[model samples]
Target: MHPALLEIARLGLHALPRASAGALRRYLETARPRLDLPPGEEIELFAPGARAVLARAFADIHHWLGQVSGRVPFFADIAQIAVPRPIPELAAAAAALPLLRADAPGHLADEAALAFLDRLAL
Candidate 1:
């Protein structure tokens, strides 16, 4: 996995609610067999479940951020992560964020996802 992507997962997971984070961890644990496969193979086999799991995580993180920041629009507009893609694709997107836009919305969302993954020690 890309180092930047891993960092983003770390950030994202940290931003999630405790329950949501725990749930994701559990999912990862159960999905370990599929997750251990090579990137493309794992995604091809696990995309559906991965998308569902990640979508829930994203929504929970967004809600949590809104509650804490009191600026739903900021998160909604900037950090809204679409869940149609697999982790590798998402990680690529996170890796693609420009250094100049480190504080951009996508970056925030990426961070949240990274944090979540990091919490799982992924």
Candidate 2:
């Protein structure tokens, strides 16, 4: 993700109330940085159930986000990560602030998604 977006995510997560979905839309727009992204490259992809998880998290409904979403946790089943270069890491860290630790579970997914976007952007 771009450094600018990372910064946006971090700031928003740390400051904004997750209860407000409207904040998320504004965050997405404000996080947009000027970039010459290449053509034919998919910068965003949503896995099945991603947005619902986000909605629950943002709503502060952790148990539902975990329960209604499934019989068992879906995202928790995967575990594999490779660290990027310092520059990329820095950029990702900045661009992915939306998914910061302070965010609720729903918002957390958004942060995770943005983290992926951060990598692709770089």
Best by lDDT: 1
- Residues 23-106 of candidate 1 have per-residue lDDT tens digits of 434433333233223344323223445656765677777787888888875465433243343445444434334331333333
- Over 1-122, each residue of candidate 2 has an lDDT whose tens digit, in order, gives 44434444455465545643335445455433433322212222333455455555544444456677874444453221121123333444443443432243333345544443344322
After aligning candidate 2 to the native by TM-score, how far in Å is the CA of 2 from where it should be?
5.9
Off by over 4 Å in 2: 1-4, 19-83, 91-122
**Model 1, C-alpha of 37: deviation from truth (Å):** 24
Q: Rate the local accuracy (lDDT) of all candidates.
A: 0.43, 0.41
Candidate 1 has an lDDT of 0.43
Model 1 weakest lDDT span, ten residues long: 99-108
